[model samples]
Target: MKIDTVKGGAYALTCTEACTVQAIRADAAFITILEADTAGQYSFVAPGEAVEVSDENAMVTQVLKPAALGVTGRSGIQSGGDVVLRNLMAEAAAFSGIVNANGGIHVPLAAGAETDTASVNRAYAMGMAQLVLMHQTRTYWLTSSCTATNGVTINHAAPGCYCEVLLGANGGTSLTLPTTGTVSGGDYSKILGYSIPFRHNGGAAGTWIKVSMLIGAGGEWTESLDAGMDGYRFRPVSGSAPSIARLVEVTLYYHEGYKSRVRELIGVGKPPGYVVRTTESSLNYDSNTNPCSAAYRLVITQSEISYTSELGAVVWLVMGGASGDTVVKLADIRGWDTYHTSVSPTLYLDVQAGEYGGRVHLESPTILNGIGNNTYVRYGLEPYQRSWITAEAEVPYKEPEQPSAS
Candidate 1:
């Protein structure tokens, strides 16, 4: 049978007796097949798609009688198939399919605000099922750039299950997930490996980082950095501050019955034909300014680079001064909001006639520095740009089965 459906509509099919469904097909996407009742009832979301259901064996029965005698054949036997036996087999198959599709379990939401001690209805993960639960407990909607830490706790975590945390920040600041637990009564040592670090790369609001941790049967945790936007490297933490991850969204996946290895949760790669161009401009400095007293300022001329967004970039600095007078230190490369005392150059370009040029890599851009004497400085930069990976949660629909009479 074929059914025409409209967008955002729910459809259901019911049968008095058990029947075998050969196949189900849809023309459009977002089609979710759900079992609404255990008594031969099924439902699905069409999402404005055309759906077709084919049932070759549809509970048909035909009886054969003796020619001479008026004795009827066996009560449950039929020409097409054994009526009672076929019904039982078909129903069993349908139930199996439902259980597999719904991840072998259903968890109802619990009371109380979501926090480190939040709990949900208990359920088992049987067969080769993968149950995923998503929650957003600590989230910050910032009007300005600031550093903050956030975390969530998952109680009664199933063995072999894992959790993923999506973190995002603004204002070219750092967002870190520490190895030590920051949440009260929370033990991060259960998670294996060191801390996870994520640099926003000084981009706009949407850039995010993904951190994944697998829970062992003994409650030991194995951690991995799934993916990050471009310009942000994923590596072990080296004495960084506690997690400044401004926004936190956690997803828990139960892989108790899963036999195979867990795959990477997120995909990260750049598009084709992507390139970075170098932007060069001359620095302006006042000669009357005391070299020992005041610092010389350098501003990026690129219109695409904004102070409010996209802060970090790669810069090439070249300065000309007397033998003893040369550029000595970099004060603040991250604009006026944050300051860095002295930073070493990533790569040295040239050093001649009291002239020095080097590649200065900064986490935040719009360079400001202090020079030794009256000098000329020229700068170049490869603006910050990156490809983002967006993480999404997919949950199956399930309805509680009604209790049968005693």
Candidate 2:
């Protein structure tokens, strides 16, 4: 079964929700919708609105697929975990293929609800695919790092698969692999560091960092949790394995349908065009760094506030990387309105993408009282595997609009 492991993966499911017909919760072949026999208001209910099932059972749909498959070749739904659900040209022609991938989109999607055989409202519903990923952990001891004569495959390649390998800290050594690949968004370092920091935080939601500014500590069980579908072969970055005991886990996320056709999603990488990154950031009442490229927008899934100081905060953006940058104040983050610590709120900048890369910064209060420590801003990194095969829900595609600077 395809299960979204990240937050925001949960939409609302109300207790008193209605369905024209029964939708089997186990099937991803179709969608669940709220119907109205009177007004013909077949409008799409947001994953936001709640819906109830049975007398209970988490009124939410675990996964979904378009109702109909297009006649396009090699363009159908598939799953990350299930090989039984696949579509071939024959299947698409016969309309007998299974739609069950972790994260993927159509080849040439049909327009409107009628032609859109999938009836997916894709433009409004999906994103970089909300990837179907696989994760595994194992302990190994390496006395030496071998370059040649021994090429070991740690995790087998899956469809639409890019590979990433990491070294463990308990062994306290870094190893290099010849088979590892880099993501188009950035590099392995950014991918691992961005989310892991805030995720492991011990705060309420492990998002916000309070009163403490302790960074770069020693004996810190640091594991370069760098794993992605960067390439087909999953191997070490180089032969630089540590000479100690280590426990390592390699996770793979891919679109089941695009396994053989794995290509770049944004610039030049794999499918599911989205990259999310975070840092142990703090604003002296005025500063934040967006770990994303110009082609992407920054959203904080989890966050932390100042423990000693309660003040106003603003989520601002700087077009291009300059000190005297244009300050676009997106929204004001009121701590009083939200929980003081581990504050997780939705903050985004309403702006257009230009040829230049922009930065999302958090500005702290210039008018607040004395505080012992700087305001810590820890962003929770949610699992984001999305694809933009259509304009569905306004997903960006190819080059991300390198428009003239506005």
TM-score of each candidate structure, all chains considered together: 0.16, 0.17
Error of 2 at 118 (Å): 6.4
Q: lDDT by residue for model 1 over 1-406, one digit each (tens)?
A: 5455554444444545433222234433333343222234443344444544444222212123212222222222323442222112121233223233323343344655474434322223221122111110111112122222333121212211211222322211123221211222122211111111111111112322222221111111122122222221221133322121111111111122101011111111232111112111222233332221122222211212222213222112222333232232211111111111112111001000101211111121111221221111222122221111122222221222322111
Clashing residue pairs found in predicted model 1: 192-221
Expressed as tens digits, the lDDT of each residue in 39-73 for candidate 2 is 11122223322233332322344334323232221
Clashes of 1: 1
**Please, what is the whole-model Cα lDDT of each candidate in the order they appear?**
0.22, 0.22
RMSD of each: 27.8, 28.3
lDDT of 1 at 184: 22
